[model samples]
Target: MAEKKAYPLRIGADVLEAMQRWADDDLRSLNAQIEYVLRAQLRQAGRLRPPVPTPAVEEKE
Candidate 1:
């Protein structure tokens, strides 16, 4: 997994409530739902690039 960064977000109460409901319906956490929505929008706008896969490191015995 890539390193996850944390940033504080400010969302309007009404918007947050709607997202919470949607998240529940989609069986996703609020944060994951938000990211999913944003990623979809970014892809629609041709602004998102495919993530590069990280190579696995072999463990030394």
Candidate 2:
């Protein structure tokens, strides 16, 4: 996992309330929900690339 840095954000009350509701519905923390939405939008806008899949390793019996 990558290290997480905290930053102060100034947001409107209505926006924060909406995010809280969405986070509740998605069963994620508010910070997680915010990051999720940002990442999704970035992918849609071609600002971020989709994650690559990891290859499965075969186990010996």
Candidate 3:
């Protein structure tokens, strides 16, 4: 997981309420909901890079 940086946001009350409801429906925290929506939009707009796949590890006999 990436370290989260805290930044104060200025959102309208109606938007915040809507986001809270969405987060509740999705079983996610409000912050996570906002990040999820933002990430989806960024991916759709090709503004964010795809995640890198981790290499598999070998087991010792």
Question: What does the lDDT read for residue 37 in candidate 2?
Answer: 96
- The ten-residue window of minimal lDDT in model 1 covers 1-10
**Which regions of candidate 3 deviate over 4 angstroms?**
58-61
User: Which window of 10 residues has the lowest lDDT sum in candidate 2?
Assistant: 1-10
Query: How much is the lDDT of residue 26 in candidate 3?
Result: 100
lDDT of each: 0.94, 0.94, 0.97
* Global lDDT of model 2: 0.94
For model 1 the TM-score comes to: 0.77
Name the TM-score of candidate 3. Answer: 0.87
Could you give the C-alpha RMSD of every candidate to the true structure, in order shown? 3.9, 1.2, 1.4
Best prediction by lDDT: 3
Per-model TM-score versus the true fold: 0.77, 0.86, 0.87
